[model samples]
Target chain A: ELKVEQNPLFLSMQEGKNYTIYCNYSTTSDRLYWYRQDPGKSLESLFVLLSNGAVKQEGRLMASLDTKARLSTLHITAAVHDLSATYFCAVSPALYSGGGADGLTFGKGTHLIIQP
Target chain B: DAGVTQSPTHLIKTRGQQVTLRCSPISGHKSVSWYQQVLGQGPQFIFQYYEKEERGRGNFPDRFSARQFPNYSSELNVNALLLGDSALYLCAAGRPQETQYFGPGTRLLVL
Candidate 1:
Protein backbone atom coordinates (compact mmCIF):
# COMPACT_ATOMS: atom_id res chain seq x y z
CA GLU A 1 0.00 0.00 0.00
CA LEU A 2 1.36 3.42 -1.00
CA LYS A 3 0.82 6.13 1.57
CA VAL A 4 1.29 9.87 1.12
CA GLU A 5 1.39 11.95 4.29
CA GLN A 6 1.35 15.73 4.48
CA ASN A 7 2.14 17.90 7.44
CA PRO A 8 0.44 21.01 8.83
CA LEU A 9 -2.97 19.72 7.82
CA PHE A 10 -4.52 22.97 9.01
CA LEU A 11 -2.76 26.29 8.71
CA SER A 12 -3.87 29.80 9.56
CA MET A 13 -1.28 32.35 8.66
CA GLN A 14 -1.09 36.04 7.99
CA GLU A 15 -0.38 37.49 4.59
CA GLY A 16 3.25 37.95 3.42
CA LYS A 17 4.45 35.11 5.62
CA ASN A 18 6.34 32.20 4.14
CA TYR A 19 5.66 28.56 4.89
CA THR A 20 6.46 25.12 3.60
CA ILE A 21 4.28 22.02 3.42
CA TYR A 22 6.05 18.70 3.45
CA CYS A 23 4.92 15.49 1.79
CA ASN A 24 6.38 12.11 2.66
CA TYR A 25 5.51 8.89 0.89
CA SER A 26 6.02 5.30 1.97
CA THR A 27 7.00 3.66 -1.32
CA THR A 28 9.48 4.28 -4.11
CA SER A 29 8.11 6.29 -6.98
CA ASP A 30 9.50 8.81 -9.43
CA ARG A 31 6.39 10.89 -10.02
CA LEU A 32 4.86 13.35 -7.57
CA TYR A 33 2.21 16.03 -8.09
CA TRP A 34 1.06 19.07 -6.15
CA TYR A 35 -2.42 20.50 -6.45
CA ARG A 36 -4.58 23.20 -4.88
CA GLN A 37 -8.33 23.04 -4.30
CA ASP A 38 -10.67 25.80 -3.31
CA PRO A 39 -13.71 25.06 -1.23
CA GLY A 40 -16.20 23.02 -3.27
CA LYS A 41 -14.06 23.35 -6.39
CA SER A 42 -12.00 21.09 -8.59
CA LEU A 43 -8.30 20.58 -8.02
CA GLU A 44 -5.88 22.90 -9.82
CA SER A 45 -2.57 21.38 -10.73
CA LEU A 46 0.39 23.24 -9.26
CA PHE A 47 3.43 21.24 -10.11
CA VAL A 48 4.45 17.86 -11.48
CA LEU A 49 7.86 16.61 -10.37
CA LEU A 50 8.75 13.70 -12.62
CA SER A 51 12.28 12.88 -11.48
CA ASN A 52 14.51 12.94 -8.45
CA GLY A 53 15.68 16.42 -7.53
CA ALA A 54 13.21 17.90 -9.95
CA VAL A 55 12.06 21.35 -8.89
CA LYS A 56 9.38 23.54 -10.39
CA GLN A 57 8.01 26.88 -9.36
CA GLU A 58 5.16 29.17 -10.18
CA GLY A 59 4.66 32.78 -9.19
CA ARG A 60 4.37 32.15 -5.46
CA LEU A 61 4.69 28.38 -5.05
CA MET A 62 7.66 26.09 -5.51
CA ALA A 63 7.67 22.29 -5.47
CA SER A 64 10.52 19.80 -5.39
CA LEU A 65 10.84 16.03 -5.34
CA ASP A 66 13.48 13.70 -3.91
CA THR A 67 12.72 10.16 -4.97
CA LYS A 68 15.48 8.47 -2.98
CA ALA A 69 14.12 9.91 0.23
CA ARG A 70 10.56 9.47 -1.01
CA LEU A 71 9.72 13.01 -0.11
CA SER A 72 8.38 16.19 -1.74
CA THR A 73 7.81 19.73 -0.56
CA LEU A 74 5.66 22.70 -1.54
CA HIS A 75 6.88 26.06 -0.42
CA ILE A 76 4.92 29.24 -0.29
CA THR A 77 6.68 32.59 -0.60
CA ALA A 78 5.11 35.72 0.86
CA ALA A 79 1.68 34.25 0.62
CA VAL A 80 -1.45 36.19 -0.14
CA HIS A 81 -5.12 35.71 0.63
CA ASP A 82 -5.70 34.31 -2.81
CA LEU A 83 -3.27 31.50 -2.00
CA SER A 84 -5.49 30.23 0.77
CA ALA A 85 -6.65 26.83 -0.31
CA THR A 86 -6.18 23.13 0.42
CA TYR A 87 -2.93 21.78 -0.97
CA PHE A 88 -2.45 18.13 -1.84
CA CYS A 89 0.46 16.00 -2.88
CA ALA A 90 -0.13 12.81 -4.81
CA VAL A 91 2.12 9.88 -5.67
CA SER A 92 1.94 7.50 -8.60
CA PRO A 93 3.44 4.06 -8.17
CA ALA A 94 5.90 2.84 -10.73
CA LEU A 95 4.65 0.09 -13.00
CA TYR A 96 6.57 -2.53 -14.87
CA SER A 97 5.29 -1.72 -18.33
CA GLY A 98 2.88 1.19 -18.58
CA GLY A 99 3.72 4.34 -16.68
CA GLY A 100 1.26 6.65 -14.93
CA ALA A 101 -1.74 4.90 -16.41
CA ASP A 102 -2.24 3.79 -12.80
CA GLY A 103 -4.23 6.05 -10.58
CA LEU A 104 -2.60 8.29 -8.00
CA THR A 105 -2.60 7.97 -4.23
CA PHE A 106 -3.13 11.33 -2.58
CA GLY A 107 -2.33 12.73 0.82
CA LYS A 108 -4.83 14.22 3.14
CA GLY A 109 -4.60 17.84 1.96
CA THR A 110 -3.26 20.77 3.94
CA HIS A 111 -5.97 23.32 4.48
CA LEU A 112 -4.47 26.80 4.49
CA ILE A 113 -6.04 30.09 5.43
CA ILE A 114 -4.23 33.31 4.68
CA GLN A 115 -5.60 36.28 6.52
CA PRO A 116 -5.03 39.82 5.30
CA ASP B 1 -8.03 23.11 -25.61
CA ALA B 2 -11.07 22.31 -23.51
CA GLY B 3 -10.41 20.52 -20.25
CA VAL B 4 -12.16 17.47 -18.87
CA THR B 5 -15.89 17.80 -18.45
CA GLN B 6 -18.42 15.96 -16.23
CA SER B 7 -22.18 15.88 -16.49
CA PRO B 8 -25.03 16.52 -14.03
CA THR B 9 -22.89 18.58 -11.68
CA HIS B 10 -25.04 17.60 -8.71
CA LEU B 11 -26.95 14.38 -8.03
CA ILE B 12 -29.19 13.10 -5.27
CA LYS B 13 -29.94 9.45 -4.57
CA THR B 14 -31.05 7.22 -1.77
CA ARG B 15 -29.51 4.13 -0.28
CA GLY B 16 -29.72 0.98 -2.45
CA GLN B 17 -30.27 3.08 -5.56
CA GLN B 18 -28.12 3.13 -8.65
CA VAL B 19 -26.28 6.05 -10.25
CA THR B 20 -24.21 6.64 -13.32
CA LEU B 21 -21.80 9.53 -13.86
CA ARG B 22 -20.35 10.63 -17.16
CA CYS B 23 -17.02 12.08 -18.26
CA SER B 24 -15.58 13.49 -21.45
CA PRO B 25 -11.84 13.63 -21.63
CA ILE B 26 -9.84 16.54 -23.01
CA SER B 27 -9.25 16.72 -26.71
CA GLY B 28 -6.67 14.16 -27.86
CA HIS B 29 -6.34 12.72 -24.37
CA LYS B 30 -6.70 8.95 -24.56
CA SER B 31 -6.66 8.17 -20.83
CA VAL B 32 -9.32 8.90 -18.27
CA SER B 33 -9.36 8.35 -14.52
CA TRP B 34 -12.01 8.58 -11.83
CA TYR B 35 -11.72 9.64 -8.20
CA GLN B 36 -13.97 10.02 -5.18
CA GLN B 37 -13.53 12.94 -2.81
CA VAL B 38 -15.29 13.34 0.47
CA LEU B 39 -15.60 16.64 2.20
CA GLY B 40 -12.42 17.75 4.00
CA GLN B 41 -10.23 15.12 2.34
CA GLY B 42 -8.22 14.57 -0.78
CA PRO B 43 -9.52 12.67 -3.76
CA GLN B 44 -9.17 8.88 -3.80
CA PHE B 45 -8.53 7.02 -6.98
CA ILE B 46 -11.18 4.63 -8.27
CA PHE B 47 -10.32 3.55 -11.77
CA GLN B 48 -8.04 4.35 -14.71
CA TYR B 49 -8.77 3.52 -18.33
CA TYR B 50 -6.44 3.78 -21.31
CA GLU B 51 -7.28 2.91 -24.85
CA LYS B 52 -10.70 1.68 -23.72
CA GLU B 53 -9.15 -0.87 -21.36
CA GLU B 54 -8.94 -0.92 -17.62
CA ARG B 55 -5.33 -0.28 -16.80
CA GLY B 56 -5.65 0.09 -13.04
CA ARG B 57 -8.15 0.03 -10.22
CA GLY B 58 -8.02 1.24 -6.65
CA ASN B 59 -9.13 -0.52 -3.48
CA PHE B 60 -12.79 0.02 -4.16
CA PRO B 61 -15.57 -2.55 -3.98
CA ASP B 62 -17.25 -4.45 -6.79
CA ARG B 63 -20.21 -2.07 -6.65
CA PHE B 64 -18.06 0.49 -8.39
CA SER B 65 -17.50 -0.11 -12.10
CA ALA B 66 -16.40 2.02 -15.06
CA ARG B 67 -15.85 1.75 -18.80
CA GLN B 68 -14.27 3.90 -21.50
CA PHE B 69 -15.69 4.42 -24.95
CA PRO B 70 -14.14 4.62 -28.40
CA ASN B 71 -14.17 8.38 -28.25
CA TYR B 72 -12.32 8.30 -24.90
CA SER B 73 -15.41 9.28 -22.98
CA SER B 74 -16.21 7.23 -19.86
CA GLU B 75 -18.96 6.36 -17.45
CA LEU B 76 -18.76 5.44 -13.78
CA ASN B 77 -21.60 3.36 -12.43
CA VAL B 78 -22.32 2.65 -8.82
CA ASN B 79 -24.70 -0.10 -7.76
CA ALA B 80 -26.31 -0.64 -4.36
CA LEU B 81 -25.19 2.75 -3.18
CA LEU B 82 -24.65 3.26 0.51
CA LEU B 83 -24.55 6.43 2.54
CA GLY B 84 -20.79 6.21 2.49
CA ASP B 85 -20.93 6.33 -1.29
CA SER B 86 -21.96 9.98 -1.24
CA ALA B 87 -19.02 12.02 -2.43
CA LEU B 88 -17.68 14.32 -5.11
CA TYR B 89 -16.83 12.14 -8.08
CA LEU B 90 -14.00 13.66 -10.14
CA CYS B 91 -12.87 12.81 -13.66
CA ALA B 92 -9.34 13.46 -14.89
CA ALA B 93 -7.92 13.22 -18.38
CA GLY B 94 -4.36 13.14 -19.66
CA ARG B 95 -1.84 11.15 -21.61
CA PRO B 96 0.40 8.56 -20.05
CA GLN B 97 3.23 9.98 -17.92
CA GLU B 98 1.66 13.41 -17.68
CA THR B 99 -0.18 15.46 -15.16
CA GLN B 100 -3.89 14.75 -15.47
CA TYR B 101 -6.30 17.68 -15.60
CA PHE B 102 -9.31 17.39 -13.30
CA GLY B 103 -12.87 18.35 -14.09
CA PRO B 104 -15.42 20.03 -11.91
CA GLY B 105 -16.59 16.99 -9.98
CA THR B 106 -20.13 15.66 -9.78
CA ARG B 107 -21.27 16.04 -6.22
CA LEU B 108 -23.42 13.08 -5.09
CA LEU B 109 -25.57 13.29 -2.03
CA VAL B 110 -27.21 10.10 -0.71
CA LEU B 111 -30.15 10.31 1.55
Candidate 2:
Protein backbone atom coordinates (compact mmCIF):
# COMPACT_ATOMS: atom_id res chain seq x y z
CA GLU A 1 0.00 0.00 0.00
CA LEU A 2 1.15 3.52 -0.71
CA LYS A 3 1.06 5.72 2.35
CA VAL A 4 1.98 9.32 3.11
CA GLU A 5 3.16 10.56 6.47
CA GLN A 6 3.54 14.17 7.50
CA ASN A 7 5.57 15.51 10.39
CA PRO A 8 4.65 18.10 12.99
CA LEU A 9 0.89 17.69 12.72
CA PHE A 10 0.47 21.04 14.43
CA LEU A 11 2.73 24.04 14.52
CA SER A 12 2.42 27.44 16.14
CA MET A 13 5.04 29.98 15.26
CA GLN A 14 5.63 33.66 15.82
CA GLU A 15 5.50 36.08 12.96
CA GLY A 16 8.69 36.19 10.88
CA LYS A 17 9.62 32.67 11.99
CA ASN A 18 10.46 29.87 9.63
CA TYR A 19 9.43 26.23 9.68
CA THR A 20 9.36 23.23 7.41
CA ILE A 21 6.68 20.55 7.03
CA TYR A 22 7.84 17.15 5.89
CA CYS A 23 6.04 14.50 3.88
CA ASN A 24 7.43 11.01 3.48
CA TYR A 25 5.96 8.36 1.26
CA SER A 26 6.28 4.60 1.28
CA THR A 27 7.08 4.16 -2.39
CA THR A 28 8.63 5.86 -5.36
CA SER A 29 6.71 8.61 -7.11
CA ASP A 30 7.20 11.00 -9.97
CA ARG A 31 5.08 13.90 -8.85
CA LEU A 32 4.34 15.76 -5.62
CA TYR A 33 1.91 18.56 -4.87
CA TRP A 34 1.50 21.08 -2.08
CA TYR A 35 -1.83 22.55 -1.14
CA ARG A 36 -3.24 24.99 1.39
CA GLN A 37 -6.65 24.66 2.96
CA ASP A 38 -8.23 27.47 4.91
CA PRO A 39 -10.86 26.73 7.51
CA GLY A 40 -13.94 25.20 5.90
CA LYS A 41 -12.59 25.87 2.42
CA SER A 42 -11.40 23.82 -0.50
CA LEU A 43 -7.75 23.08 -1.07
CA GLU A 44 -5.74 25.65 -3.02
CA SER A 45 -2.87 24.25 -5.05
CA LEU A 46 0.47 25.73 -4.09
CA PHE A 47 3.17 23.82 -5.92
CA VAL A 48 3.56 20.83 -8.19
CA LEU A 49 7.02 19.37 -7.84
CA LEU A 50 7.60 17.09 -10.83
CA SER A 51 11.11 15.71 -10.49
CA ASN A 52 13.85 14.97 -8.04
CA GLY A 53 15.33 18.17 -6.63
CA ALA A 54 12.31 20.00 -8.03
CA VAL A 55 11.64 23.24 -6.23
CA LYS A 56 8.85 25.76 -6.63
CA GLN A 57 8.27 28.93 -4.71
CA GLU A 58 5.52 31.48 -4.37
CA GLY A 59 5.98 34.39 -2.02
CA ARG A 60 6.85 33.11 1.42
CA LEU A 61 6.14 29.47 0.63
CA MET A 62 8.52 27.07 -1.06
CA ALA A 63 8.28 23.34 -1.76
CA SER A 64 10.89 20.78 -2.74
CA LEU A 65 10.87 17.13 -3.71
CA ASP A 66 13.44 14.35 -3.31
CA THR A 67 12.32 11.24 -5.16
CA LYS A 68 15.31 9.19 -4.00
CA ALA A 69 14.48 9.83 -0.39
CA ARG A 70 10.75 9.62 -1.14
CA LEU A 71 10.23 12.86 0.73
CA SER A 72 8.84 16.31 0.08
CA THR A 73 8.94 19.46 2.14
CA LEU A 74 6.89 22.62 2.38
CA HIS A 75 8.85 25.45 3.89
CA ILE A 76 7.39 28.61 5.31
CA THR A 77 9.63 31.69 5.47
CA ALA A 78 8.85 34.79 7.47
CA ALA A 79 5.48 33.41 8.40
CA VAL A 80 2.50 35.67 8.97
CA HIS A 81 -0.96 35.22 10.42
CA ASP A 82 -2.51 35.41 7.01
CA LEU A 83 -0.44 32.41 5.98
CA SER A 84 -2.00 30.24 8.64
CA ALA A 85 -3.69 27.19 7.16
CA THR A 86 -3.53 23.43 6.92
CA TYR A 87 -0.83 22.48 4.44
CA PHE A 88 -0.94 19.12 2.70
CA CYS A 89 1.44 17.20 0.46
CA ALA A 90 0.11 14.82 -2.15
CA VAL A 91 2.19 12.35 -4.12
CA SER A 92 1.17 11.14 -7.52
CA PRO A 93 2.80 7.83 -8.30
CA ALA A 94 3.43 8.53 -11.95
CA LEU A 95 3.56 11.40 -14.36
CA TYR A 96 1.17 9.74 -16.81
CA SER A 97 -2.50 10.13 -16.10
CA GLY A 98 -3.18 6.39 -16.30
CA GLY A 99 -1.70 5.24 -13.01
CA GLY A 100 -5.22 4.06 -12.13
CA ALA A 101 -5.84 2.97 -8.53
CA ASP A 102 -2.49 4.30 -7.38
CA GLY A 103 -3.62 7.87 -7.56
CA LEU A 104 -2.48 10.69 -5.35
CA THR A 105 -1.91 9.82 -1.72
CA PHE A 106 -2.00 12.81 0.58
CA GLY A 107 -0.38 13.54 3.90
CA LYS A 108 -2.47 14.08 6.98
CA GLY A 109 -1.70 17.78 6.72
CA THR A 110 0.06 20.27 8.95
CA HIS A 111 -2.17 22.69 10.77
CA LEU A 112 -0.07 25.83 11.02
CA ILE A 113 -0.89 28.85 13.15
CA ILE A 114 1.16 31.99 13.00
CA GLN A 115 0.91 34.34 15.97
CA PRO A 116 1.68 38.00 15.73
CA ASP B 1 -13.17 29.56 -15.51
CA ALA B 2 -15.20 28.46 -12.58
CA GLY B 3 -13.36 25.91 -10.49
CA VAL B 4 -14.91 22.60 -9.46
CA THR B 5 -18.36 23.08 -7.91
CA GLN B 6 -20.39 20.93 -5.53
CA SER B 7 -24.01 21.27 -4.45
CA PRO B 8 -25.68 21.50 -1.02
CA THR B 9 -22.78 22.91 0.94
CA HIS B 10 -24.15 21.01 3.94
CA LEU B 11 -26.36 17.96 4.42
CA ILE B 12 -27.80 15.83 7.18
CA LYS B 13 -28.90 12.23 6.80
CA THR B 14 -30.25 9.58 9.07
CA ARG B 15 -28.52 6.25 9.31
CA GLY B 16 -29.62 3.75 6.65
CA GLN B 17 -30.96 6.56 4.50
CA GLN B 18 -29.66 7.12 1.01
CA VAL B 19 -28.11 10.32 -0.26
CA THR B 20 -26.90 11.65 -3.55
CA LEU B 21 -24.30 14.37 -3.87
CA ARG B 22 -23.52 16.29 -7.01
CA CYS B 23 -20.41 17.81 -8.58
CA SER B 24 -19.64 19.80 -11.70
CA PRO B 25 -16.11 19.86 -12.96
CA ILE B 26 -14.23 22.80 -14.37
CA SER B 27 -15.02 23.75 -17.92
CA GLY B 28 -13.38 21.51 -20.53
CA HIS B 29 -12.09 19.15 -17.89
CA LYS B 30 -12.87 15.54 -18.75
CA SER B 31 -12.16 13.80 -15.50
CA VAL B 32 -13.97 13.87 -12.16
CA SER B 33 -13.02 12.30 -8.88
CA TRP B 34 -14.65 11.89 -5.48
CA TYR B 35 -13.19 11.80 -2.00
CA GLN B 36 -14.43 11.47 1.58
CA GLN B 37 -12.67 13.23 4.40
CA VAL B 38 -13.27 12.76 8.08
CA LEU B 39 -12.60 15.57 10.48
CA GLY B 40 -8.95 14.76 11.18
CA GLN B 41 -7.69 12.79 8.21
CA GLY B 42 -6.64 13.44 4.68
CA PRO B 43 -9.25 12.91 1.98
CA GLN B 44 -9.75 9.31 0.85
CA PHE B 45 -10.32 8.62 -2.78
CA ILE B 46 -13.69 7.14 -3.69
CA PHE B 47 -14.10 7.09 -7.43
CA GLN B 48 -12.71 8.54 -10.62
CA TYR B 49 -14.70 8.98 -13.80
CA TYR B 50 -13.29 9.88 -17.17
CA GLU B 51 -15.00 10.06 -20.51
CA LYS B 52 -18.29 9.16 -18.81
CA GLU B 53 -16.90 5.82 -17.66
CA GLU B 54 -15.58 4.54 -14.42
CA ARG B 55 -11.82 4.77 -14.53
CA GLY B 56 -10.77 4.05 -10.98
CA ARG B 57 -12.29 2.98 -7.69
CA GLY B 58 -10.89 3.09 -4.21
CA ASN B 59 -11.22 0.51 -1.48
CA PHE B 60 -14.71 1.62 -0.59
CA PRO B 61 -17.66 -0.73 -0.41
CA ASP B 62 -20.23 -1.30 -3.11
CA ARG B 63 -22.76 0.81 -1.26
CA PHE B 64 -20.90 3.78 -2.72
CA SER B 65 -21.06 4.52 -6.43
CA ALA B 66 -20.75 7.40 -8.87
CA ARG B 67 -21.18 8.30 -12.51
CA GLN B 68 -20.09 11.05 -14.83
CA PHE B 69 -22.31 12.77 -17.34
CA PRO B 70 -21.77 14.02 -20.86
CA ASN B 71 -21.19 17.49 -19.52
CA TYR B 72 -18.52 16.15 -17.17
CA SER B 73 -20.78 16.67 -14.16
CA SER B 74 -21.01 13.79 -11.72
CA GLU B 75 -23.01 12.33 -8.87
CA LEU B 76 -22.10 10.21 -5.88
CA ASN B 77 -24.71 7.87 -4.49
CA VAL B 78 -24.47 6.23 -1.14
CA ASN B 79 -26.90 3.48 -0.28
CA ALA B 80 -27.66 2.05 3.18
CA LEU B 81 -25.44 4.60 4.73
CA LEU B 82 -23.95 4.04 8.16
CA LEU B 83 -22.98 6.71 10.63
CA GLY B 84 -19.41 6.16 9.52
CA ASP B 85 -20.34 7.68 6.23
CA SER B 86 -20.75 11.04 7.86
CA ALA B 87 -17.94 13.08 6.39
CA LEU B 88 -17.04 15.86 4.05
CA TYR B 89 -17.48 14.83 0.43
CA LEU B 90 -15.15 16.63 -1.92
CA CYS B 91 -15.25 16.73 -5.71
CA ALA B 92 -12.21 17.34 -7.85
CA ALA B 93 -11.72 17.76 -11.57
CA GLY B 94 -8.78 17.44 -13.87
CA ARG B 95 -7.62 16.03 -17.17
CA PRO B 96 -6.97 12.31 -17.67
CA GLN B 97 -4.24 12.50 -15.09
CA GLU B 98 -3.45 15.97 -13.86
CA THR B 99 -3.53 18.03 -10.74
CA GLN B 100 -7.11 18.07 -9.51
CA TYR B 101 -8.93 21.26 -8.63
CA PHE B 102 -11.12 20.84 -5.57
CA GLY B 103 -14.52 22.22 -4.79
CA PRO B 104 -15.91 23.56 -1.54
CA GLY B 105 -16.90 20.19 -0.09
CA THR B 106 -20.31 19.16 1.14
CA ARG B 107 -20.30 18.55 4.87
CA LEU B 108 -22.57 15.61 5.66
CA LEU B 109 -23.74 14.78 9.12
CA VAL B 110 -25.23 11.36 9.78
CA LEU B 111 -27.50 10.71 12.70
Off by over 4 Å in 2: A95-98
lDDT, candidate 2, at B20: 96
CAPRI docking class of candidate 1: medium
The candidate that achieves the highest TM-score relative to the unseen native structure: 1
For model 2, residues B1-111, the per-residue Cα lDDT tens digits are 788899989999999999999999999998888989888788888888888988778889999999989998999999998999999999988875467889999999999
Per-prediction TM-score: 0.97, 0.96
lDDT of 1 by residue, A2-87 (tens): 89999989999999999999999998787899999999899999999999999999999999998989999999999999999999
The DockQ figures for the candidates are 0.80, 0.60
Query: Which candidate gets the maximum DockQ versus the true structure?
Result: 1
In candidate 2 chain B, where is summed lDDT lowest over 10 consecutive residues? Answer: B92-101
A40-79 per-residue lDDT for model 2 (tens digits)? 8888889888789999899999899999999998888999
Cα lDDT, all candidates: 0.93, 0.87
